[model samples]
Target: MATVRRKCFISYHHADQDAVNQFVRDFDQAHNCFIARGLGEEMPGDVINSNNTDYVMAKIRERFLADSTVTIVLLGRCTWARRYVDWEIQSSLRRGQYSTPNGLLGIKLPSYSGSFPERFNQNLSSDFPRIDCYARHMSYPSSTSALVDAIEEAYQRRTTHQNLIVNPRARMSYNRQCQ
Candidate 1:
């Protein structure tokens, strides 16, 4: 039987929806992937205001927390300040079931300015791993390959940690007997 490739849960600010959508489309074409944005019912016009931010975030969390192996945070300038983006990143970290070594990976989007957002500066001490997607995009011959490499590396780290946790006996044995 053929093995299924892992599905990635993409988290991003609504303001960066166009870039996120483009990334999703390109990534999907290049690799086996799935994205959670725009996959549900359209938001009511009345429910579109910032006052309903919590409600919108809850919906994003519900959609992303199921059947996804990785959570990729597409970081734009406005991403860090957005409440729902922050909530999603925090929620992904807190989830016991889907926890991975690199439970969260932040991808810095391409922009003219090289500086990170102020919110990110304040929250840099947090556990999420951050990588410059723009740099990676420029480094590789193709953006698709660069993204694939990033995803694979992060997934491998997560799976390796999962293996260690699930097989503590082996870890203990190696430390005591083999070492």
Candidate 2:
């Protein structure tokens, strides 16, 4: 059985770069399970410096998040506190005039613990009926199939349960204390 490949945009703290790189190498570069886009991939390392939030988000949506169908957040020890991660999540969930919202998925890195990103948390709900959730949070992928399944599930939710998405939270202006 062949695994399905989805276009995935990875969101992670720079602190978790090694882990994120390893993950991409294993699941994407090596196995070709999915198309990976993030820092040093499709996304640029530096964003425009400006006080205008709308401009920045528009640039991000146009350049990085436009083609992605799923946003894979790599949750490391302090990934939840990064402001950029919050914006990325916000951009991923926002429905643009041309693109629909990307499926949000949080993958706990091997070193993950402590708080989660507030914006990412907004879309992730453990309680079910499950109608109020737009994302899935889970531990690291055990195999290519597991990761693909999660991505596919999220991809389906873009159309199946998009109404459940909660993306109205104000964007975080600064990183919070991890503890």
Candidate 3:
């Protein structure tokens, strides 16, 4: 079967921006396997710097994630400690009147030091009865085919495992310190 190309929203920490850029350049631009959309290097100062969580989440959903069907989080060393990463994960999994929740996946980047974003883990499962999980956490893609397959799996899970999502937890107000 031919691989399906998905429109994916990349949720990642700015600290790993370089790696994320490379991944998009290699996987989407070079291979043409999927369409990658995100903030890139532009940080919308007004929205991101706001103290209101609702405002931030709304802006993120409207601008960054509106057209995406899947969310690929590039997990870096400090990703787990970032509140914005948590909000992004929450927004991706949230189902609203105008949008259905996006499929979620976590990609462990080379800078990853065995720490995972707290909110990302809420939706990801590693235990038995795997079908209950809403997200997949995997190592960085080694090839075009690997990334494409993972994206497809996430897209399929949007509906198949929608009910298993655990996104209702309280949003993180401040960044946490990772051990």
Q: What TM-score goes with each of the models?
A: 0.56, 0.88, 0.89
**CA RMSD of all predictions:** 12.7, 2.4, 2.6
The count of residue-pair clashes in candidate 2 stands at 1
- Give the runs in model 2 whose Cα sits over 4 Å from its true position: 41-52, 126-132
Clashing pairs in 2: 80-117
lDDT of all the models against the reference?
0.47, 0.83, 0.83
- Indicate the TM-score of model 2: 0.88
lDDT per residue, candidate 3, 29-98, as tens digits?
8898788777784322233567788987888887878888999999999999999888888889988676
Candidate 2 vs candidate 3, lDDT winner = 3
Q: Clashing residue pairs in candidate 3, if any?
A: none
Better of 1 and 3 by lDDT: 3
How much RMSD separates candidate 2 from the native structure? 2.4
Model 1 TM-score relative to the real fold: 0.56
User: Top model by lDDT, which number?
Assistant: 3
lDDT per residue, candidate 2, 1-179, as tens digits? 66668888888998888888899889888888788876644334455678787888777777767878999999999998888888889889887576689999899998898567888887877677754678888889988788888999999999887887788768888888875
* Error at 58, model 2, angstroms: 2.2
Sort by TM-score, top down from the best: 3, 2, 1
